[model samples]
Target chain A: MRGVVTLHADGLSKDFGERSALRDVSFEVSEGERVAVIGPNGAGKTTLLSLLAGLQRATAGTVSRPPEEIGWVPQQAALYRRLSIRENLRLFARLERVADPDAAVDRALELTGLADRAKDELSTLSGGNQQRVNIAIGLLADPPVLLLDEPSSSLDPRQRAVLWDFIDGLAAGGTAVIFATHEIDEAQRHADRILVLGDGELIFTGTAAELHAAGGDDDLVVAFVRVLEAQGH
Target chain B: MRWLLLKDLQILRRSPLLIGLLVVYPVVISLLIGFALSRGPDKPKIAFVNEVPELQQTINVGGDQIDIASYSDRLFERVDPVPAATREEALQMVEDGEVLGALIIPEDAGRKLQTAVALGGSAEKPTVEVLYDASGPLQGQLVESLVDSTLAEANVAIGERITEVSAGYLNILLDGGSFSLLGQDFDILGLAEAERILGRQAAQLPAGSTERAELERIRRFAELAVENLDFSDEILSSISNPIDVKETPVGSSGGTTLESFAVSASVVFSLMFVCVLLAAGMLALEREEHAYGRLVRGLVSRGKLLAEKVLLAALCALPVGLVMLVVVALLADLDWGRAPLWTVGVLATGLAFGALGVAIGAVAREVRAASLLAFGLSLPIAFLALVPAGTVADPLYEVIRVVSAAFPFKPSLLAMDAALNETGDMWPSVLHLLGLTAAYGVLARVALRRFG
Candidate 1:
């Protein structure tokens, strides 16, 4: 909130017909901040990201960000199945109206380490490679902020480590990154600050150390399990 | 934009069903139309009954003179000639389907002509009856005309012979009154004298002037002759007009061959409009897949993404349209003289339709709903192309005409036809297609705002 805020959301809320998905949710991520948004399946972590990404309009809230300032990688890999890896990158570059699409695509492919398989169709790529392509698409416009949802969900441990390292490098380069994941260990490893949601409301906001010290009795996951057990889960 | 276009092109290349439909449809249509237009004859059996030997002789002579055998060979593969024992038998043959038709010469026909000639007057014409199955009008008419032509020639010949004999008898009566030949001629003269005496006795009773009666009779006879001649000429003209409008292929550019090819080409290209629906569905799928959310987060505006999808669909539609055009050209033997014009027209039409499809698809949330709506809207538009310009006289067709004029494919068809046949105004159709393209573009843009 102090540094030049990359994203600022105040009193953000969403309603679908009769059901409210989120209610007056507000948060801000400063420049180069690595934030992890964690919640149970229906706790509206996805909705928050969607609102932040400008995919859905808030019922009442204010979101301030420059156009094309955020790079989003969806939970599911959004790679075009019919297009080759390079072609998919090129399509995003062209759509973004990048002046030199070929160079932009080449750079993105190199960043994602998918340069070697540029000519291969997306369908032929493994789930991990496809995820990399999706990430590459988000990186094509070279936006200052990256928003990823469950980016490591489909990858193996090795692939996940590679992705975490990539995100760490991006953060080091002063690109703010916010990702949503259920994996507490991965979040603790990469995230500078962690935000937790429970039943459509933000329950916790602090660093991993603070969260662990507060729990005291066990780790973050163990604490969550004990809390669920107390509720007769 | 180029990348989006290239990606779509790659997808189109892999679709085998699309390729086959694009290439084969026009060729099949062309072959069907060609087969229908080819001249082929029908074979029908004919039976005849000739009670008078002279009548049969006249028919044989007339048939030989007209080259009936050669004509029949060219017209029909089989010409069965059955001789009936009696007039009733000939008629029965026709009823029983033993033959298509039968011609009967009356038994007293020759005797009646001879008596009328002896009396120094026009002959009582022998009546020839033609029996035919009413179920087959064309065949019945053909057989009837053939027989009638033969009878007409015989009548003309008999008329000339009777006129000569009457003239000779009159001269003999006028110059040589008392001779051996007089007995033969005077025997008929006695009956004429008796008939004259009876006419004079009847005329004594006052009714009207003889001159008036004679004038009225002459007028009636003249009217009857004119009516008969006109009727005969009308029938003959109708017969001649059969198959008169032979559609010769105008250097492979005109006639039913090209017309059918154009129709198939139009249909094939029209289907390319479905690509718009596919593009629309792709957009919907993106929303379902949460890709839109990702793009939004990536700072891609809704409008830009929608624009990109529309552009992609239009780009895809171009080659699909071209593939259809190429297929038609190769398979249907489409004349290449106007290929450039057709290609341009088809491309414009394809873009308009593609845009329209995207618009429709955008409104529906799922592929099933989008497909149903797209297909429903396009079916009526496609149907409009089937109605021939000359035959579209109904009020509903006029409405369809107005609506279809607003679609690029219809105008493209109109332009193509005009280019190939030079039958309609091409400029108006071109303008119409342009207007449709603009309208579709506007609609697509509007749809993006409403449903994007």
Candidate 2:
């Protein structure tokens, strides 16, 4: 179902004073493509997503679409814990300037499979359910491109499976999903393309099998490590 | 108890903000208030309507000429005088709050006083009017007392002058007389008898004689002069109390002192504390819960987001303010003067202080910090704003006035006073509140960008 490119970052660079957080980072994500940005700490994974979302100003770069057209989900819950799940969705939906907020909230709840607990406050929900509400807010505007920073870093195995399944549904519906993660296996299994970052630079961009051949290792984790080590990360 | 105390200490140690609120805030407020009290209070200006400035003439007093017309003008050192052109202008100044009270000296007052002093007596006494708003009893009484003291001093000076003139005339009369009785020279009756014989002789021969006509004029002059001296006792008594000082209450306050205080205190203090806490706590909670970032990233602009929070705070404070007013009205039987205007004043006060609270929240890093900062400052702000003009040193009061003017505290209080008391105009306060709201709103946005 992948089609024309829906997201493009060209020569993106972000600098905090003299130290660079992200430099010359470039990538293209097509509709329905799941791109995983894999990097160690301080490798600018979050910075890259923030730059693409226009929440931050890049030192030098350009994004193809306007910032409003892209959905951004940060690492934290970043929600009102006292409010119910449906209330949270409706508030964000209204912020997104959706034509019909109630309809948008309903769709987000159904898409996240959280309709049964829609009335439950986020503070009372389990970790996985809270994460579902987080993603639900990002999906409120139905942006063609979704950027999540570590979507499943804190979830259990079953919760992680539920999250990836939900993401797969979005991708299948022609929404390009970009996620930053430390899990190499997750990147290999779920990503249509893997972007390896080393010291604020893009070191590799290829499929899991192609990365395995280049890294001279069968295991995806070894390949990811080798890819980073080759660039002296 | 020791273990519990230790546990409480451990909890307190974790909150620097609470410690600051309990320790530093009080010390700072105390110092400020102590400093203000150390300086003497400034006097409010009283308007003076001198209608006889042109009749500035000197009269003889105890062998020395005194400028009687300028005596009252020189006696107003205790209270600053704002010279008004007319009685109407002076009263208007009081109504407009330009001056706390007005003193109106009626037309030809100087001429009348001069003539009375020259003739040594008069049938009519000139009166000056003192006008003040009855609703502001404290200020009104203060102004009235100052005017009374000044007029009393003027009366003493005039009485001394009159006594000196009478003494001078008594010496002249005794020197001119030759008769003596009971060890005191007495000649007024003998002189009157001689003048009566001269007038009788002159009348018999005054058909066509120039000498007889001259004798008649001399006799008439002597007779009138003796009669004027005979009335000296009455003149001396009247000179001691010449000017009539009348106190006129401009606007009536049907309530007691406690009722007036209830209206002003409830509006100013309640709105200030409530609106500030509500707005600051709201933003602090949002930041503490990690939702502020998400909110900023949404489609709403930073200004609009701040506006929404500030508006919510103000709206919430409005009911609290109204409830306090209603409760006080029920308990104290107070007249809320112009309900619609008072409501507007309350709402304006809320909006202004709510914006200030939002600014405080934006600068603070956590909920506790914001709460402490808002609560810690509200009481002092209210106190300084309501510290009745003359209660602090002139320089300190000037600084306080400037600070309160820049903010919405004093203006809102004054506006509410106008609305509730119907003593002056309320539009100025509303205008100031709106202006301050905009300024604080902008400050909140800037702080959010820097610290939020």
Candidate that would win on DockQ: 2
**Tens-place lDDT digits, model 2, residues A157-184:** 9999999999988999999999999999
Cα deviation of B216, candidate 1, in Å: 43
lDDT of predicted model 2: 0.80
Q: Can you tell me the DockQ of model 2?
A: 0.38
Provide all candidates' interface root-mean-square deviations: 3.1, 1.7
B217-298 per-residue lDDT for model 2 (tens digits): 8888878877777766565756686677888876544222544655776678878878888889888888887777667764
DockQ of all candidates, in order?
0.22, 0.38
Error of 1 at B215 (Å): 40
Candidate 2 Cα outliers beyond 4 Å, as residue runs: A213-216, B1-31, B37-258, B329-337
Residue pair clashes in candidate 2: none
- Which numbered prediction scores highest in TM-score against the true structure? 2
lDDT for B266 (candidate 2): 67
